[model samples]
Target: MEDSKKIIIVGAGLCGSLLALRLVQRGFKVELFEKRPDMRRKELDAGRSINLALSSRGLWALDRVGLKDRVLETCIPMKGRLVHPIDGDAFLSPYSGRADDHINSVSRPGLNALLLDVAELNDDIQIRFECSVQKVNLEQARVEGFDHKNNCSFSSQGAIVIGTDGAGSVVRRTLMARTPELLFNYSQDFLRHGYKELSILPDSNGGFKIAKNALHIWPRGHFMIIALPNLDASFTLTMFHPYESEIGFNNLKTKEQLKAFFEKYYADLLPYIPHYQEEYFSNPVGNLGTIKCYPWQAYGKCLIMGDASHAIVPFYGQGMNASFEDVREFDELMDVHGDDWDKLFTSFQDKRHKNTNAIADLAIDNFYEMRDRVDDIDFKEKRKLEMHLEQNYKEYYSKYSMVTFRPELPYEKAMILGRKQDEILLNMVRDKSQVVNVDRVLTKIKELHENMRNEI
Candidate 1:
């Protein structure tokens, strides 16, 4: 008889839970371990945080597991970015060419709850909340961790232990010790920016003070504040600024200093935020981290996915989306390998490492573009060239359309193509002599697309 195959997944966050669901659906016995108490047992305070932008990449993964429609029930779609310029009214900026194309904001804990519920229905999956891995025996394919009672330590042997754990992952550390060479090429940059959340309470008439279908951005040169809609007709606003900014909450400790900073920087939106002073001063600061790693899976017996593999900066609004994509890519590899555990895992790592790295860089680059360059005239001109490329080479070339709208292309390939396109467009824009010739650029864009297609 074939041996009973088992997989241990650490960290029951979004990606971990989804991985459990997918594995169980394929008839594999799966054990999910989480360090946190069951989230449902306690109130997840809004003071901590709320939603994430559920983009196409994220939605596709959920849909594969039959969870998308349910997730959509709680999501509020952000049709376009509402940029709050320094002097003018906020204007809508479309990312995918069409105004209707959008990413949705859904509560993080809410989505977690849904995934957990579905996972519970899988008899093949055993979820152990409040259980932490104390040690991992990579040679033996086993995990030693504390149980829920926190008294006796227990050891469990599985075919492989996959670390879906977050950035500071114990499993990852264990993997590092056992197989130092497999240690991914990793780097992290903590942007000077930090974030604090504030709420816009629903109006007395139960109406939203801001547009419910928009991701609002107040872009100042060194900082930005973005607000995404919630189901309760309220918006969750996040204030992001350089750690060294004189107006940061740390420096503006007094109410007078805080108020003066807000008045000068975010005057129009301040009144909409209830208890702005209290929330701003009292809320904990959220840090932005960009992480890149390689070789996500070890053979077919062990693997890492999601944040454990790539923790990206949130500026691109893609941390969760990329994690979800990791799940889908693994699943696809499983299909290609015909459920051969070893082959499936080997293929997964080979296929997904570059994709994850590409998104990490994309996320970092977007930080600069969003906060400092989005409104620059030169940048806008380049964006215009991108539009021309998309229109003229609809079949061969696309920038936002492919990255944001198409899920067929791997993340790494999309980034590669995007960089190539960016280089071409930058050159076109740098030539002031050709600035007035739109038709000439269109011809160049088509030729570039043909050359790119042939090379691919």
Candidate 2:
């Protein structure tokens, strides 16, 4: 392939920076445009979800760029979710088989900066900050943007324009406007629930108040609190609650109401958050929404990826993972088609649209499972058996293992395969049939496992 093709990438966020690096590596000239200032120089806004859980799908992409070790340097590995029971002792359950079945906890801005730095290192990729994408002109294959300081509009023509822009993507909006009948469906469902971040500052001894190597969840049915570790030995705690509850922060105007609410509902978290009073009042509430769209590409000259294509709730922590996978897939398709823009993009959209929608749906469904059902007696028993199946069957069976630890299987196929296996196990439990032996189940799972491995 020639090294002269020029590409304009909008939004130098995680997905955008990664795609730029990959494209540059393939001998394409790339320019990255970002609306925000140099994130490396600025701190993330206080109330935003400052960090996220990075799993296999995301790590695999970094590995492709030869940056896995460098990225891991800033991460704290969490072995599993530490479930805090309302009336009993907290229990930590591993997501994968071995003690090392873990996910990395790292700051969003930190990861983004690392990716941007790597992108900049490549002479082929030129990054422009404070450049807001205003529109995409598909006819001319160019991107129009506004300079923040000069208030002047600028334009760049490219072989192709990729919108790694976020949910409110100008590129996507422009693409849809140009092709209204492209089988695109767009919707955003705002959850009645909202989230706010509170910090568990490091103790005097410079250690975490709770386990640093675990994701702590204070699941209280209608509302829950989760804390993820930071490299600074502090924990970023998020409170997810209904927008309007009897004793929520919604209607509480006085400190008395605030104290009463915290003492009653979030008592488990109060001790760890010593400055809760101040944080509770100051932190801005973040609205939760699920964004869905179809046919993520328009003409050969333009396409959409990441949250711009399918933004889901953060419960499954798969948003970043899915977006990273998109970058990898797009890069591979471009590689296979030898820069035949139309052929490569058509193939990418056909394969990626279904995969993105499936994961987006799963992310939405996971919210209820985390908030309302993780602690249910029957659900817990089933999950325990599911974990056992992952170990016993080893080759054919897995629950959390496939979702978090493996990126080889497509998200939709993994979901379908898991449900079928769970249904078989659930039937056995319902009938209390010991004759429905574990060995028999393992035998059945082995065949399915073989199929799954091959399909991926």
lDDT of 2: 0.80
lDDT of 1 at 201: 82
Please give, for residues 103-181, the per-residue lDDT of candidate 1 as tens digits.
8999998899899999889788888888888787765667888887666777778887889898777876665665566
What is the TM-score of each predicted model, taking all chains together?
Answer: 0.92, 0.93
Q: How many backbone clashes does candidate 2 have?
A: 0
TM-score: model 1 vs. ground truth: 0.92
Q: For candidate 2, lDDT tens digit of each residue in 113-172? A: 888887788788878888898978875668888988677887788888889898889988
Highest lDDT against the true fold, candidate: 2
The residue pairs found clashing in candidate 2 are none
Candidate 1, clashing residue pairs?
192-243
Which segments of model 2 are wrong by more than 4 Å?
1-4, 47-49, 247-249, 429-456
Number of clashes recorded per candidate: 1, 0
